[model samples]
Target: MPYAVDFDTVSTAGLESSPVAPALAGLRANEARYFRNKYAHVFAVEPAGDAPEAVDWVHHILDAERGIVISSPALEATTFQVENIRMAYVFYRSGLSINVMYTVDDGGKRAVGFKLSDGMDVPDELASFKFARQRSKLAGTIRGSYFVIKNEY
Candidate 1:
């Protein structure tokens, strides 16, 4: 068989003011359009019976993605399905806990969009979130955490 290849590359370092910013913005717009068109219904949040519209997707992404970035370099690309998202676990530092739920849609058909935490209260002033995930079902045992958010900063 024969094939042709086309590739485009650019730096995404400067962010909003950079030359590549528009492209990134365009991509994000396209993603939003696609999400609205196809999966809008699958994603949403509300007052939950007047508890106050509590989920902050932005914060969730900041926290989770930031954690992923500063974390050990070898721990990217791993996946897991965290549970009990309805509740949270706040540490002694007062940062709330969260479950970054991951699902294998269509039985490996493709990975689904990463959803942010519905409930959490981390302090502002941090450009992005960075943290540790020490999971111990029983006391004194620390599980491992690994992942990264490339687009978020």
Candidate 2:
């Protein structure tokens, strides 16, 4: 079952297994808010078990583009298209959120983003990328980084 994240009142219903459930939930809500505000799209996510394709796609991109593999288990994931952009998101138990933004048009913008919850340490695989901090009302302090996608997916 997919859950539509509520930015107004963030909850940890499906993310209870994570040690940093609150921060993770907040991070998820922050994403929901972004889509809702920017594109009038509802950001809904399903359990990783129910969204294997989305998770796998994200993993494949991470591994192929950066030679990176996340050790943490993914809790939830979603994939959707808005305008010309195909977007995918995977939230992990370690309070990490990864997003892939691929524009459908040739020569358009494409990138993979990583966002860490307030209290979690940067995972070993992502240590080489420098993360910049941003403050969010719902997610607190979020550390984020990204790399441009080189190969077509």
Candidate 3:
């Protein structure tokens, strides 16, 4: 079953297994609010076991583009299409969240983003990447980074 993230209230009903569940939930909620405000799209997440395709999609890109594989166990994932962008998110047990945003149209934006929840350490794979800080009432201080996608998937 998928849990529809409530941007307004910010809940982590299905993400309790993560070590930093509170921060992860808030991070999820921050994303929900982004889509809701920018594109009027609702963000919904499912257990990682239940969303194999979504997880695979993100993993495929990580391996192909960066030769990177996440070390943490994935707790939940979600994928949605809005306008020309296909967005996928994976939340990990280490409180790290990754997202892939691929634009369908040519010459549009394409990138993979990594975000760390409050109180979590940066994973080894992303240790070199510089993260920008963003303050969110729902998520607290979010440290994030991104790399442009050079290949079409």
Candidate 4:
């Protein structure tokens, strides 16, 4: 079943196994707040096991673009299209969140973003990228980095 992320009252429903569950929940809420504010859309997620295609799409980009593979166990994921953008989000047990943003129209923006939850170390795969900090009431100081998509997927 899908559950809408609640920014007002964050929950770690599917992320309880993570050591940084609180921070992960906050990170999840941050994304929810963003969509609600910018797109007037609700951000919802389901168990990663239930969304194999979404997980596979992310893996395909990671492999093709950078030869990178994340070993972290994905706990929850969601894929949706809104306002011409196809987005896929996966939350890992390591408190890492990755999102693939692909614009539907050709020649538009496409990239993979990585956001680290509070108190989690930068994953080895993303250690080379410099993360910029952004403050959020729900997520605290968020460190984020992204790389532009190089090939069609």
Whose TM-score is greatest here? Answer: 2
List ranges where model 2 is wrong by over 4 Å.
none
Backbone clashes in model 2, listed as residue pairs: none
lDDT of each: 0.26, 0.96, 0.93, 0.95
Clashing pairs in 4: none
Tens digit of per-residue lDDT, candidate 3, span 58-127: 9999999999999999999999999999999999989999999999999989999999999999898988
Better of 1 and 3 by lDDT: 3
In candidate 3, how many Å is residue 144 off? 0.2
Q: Could you tell me the C-alpha RMSD of candidate 1 in Å?
A: 17.1
Q: For every candidate structure, what is the RMSD over all alpha carbons to the true structure, in angstroms? A: 17.1, 0.5, 0.9, 0.7
TM-scores for every predicted model:
0.24, 0.99, 0.97, 0.98
Off-target runs (Cα >4 Å) in candidate 3 are none
If the candidates were sorted by their TM-score against the true structure, best first, what order would they fall in? 2, 4, 3, 1
Inter-residue clash pairs, candidate 1: none
lDDT of 2 by residue, 66-142 (tens): 89999999999999999999999999999999999999999999999999998999999999999999999999999
What's the CA error at residue 106 for candidate 2, in Å? 0.6
Comparing 2 and 3 on lDDT, the stronger one:
2
lDDT of 4: 0.95
- Per-residue lDDT tens digits of candidate 4, residues 1-153? 889999999888999999999999999999999999999999999999999999999989998999889989999999999899999999999999999999989999999999999999998988889999998899888899999998888
TM-score of 3: 0.97
Which digits, one per residue and each the tens of the lDDT, describe model 1 over residues 61-136? 5455553221211101112122312221111111122223333342221111221111223334332435333322
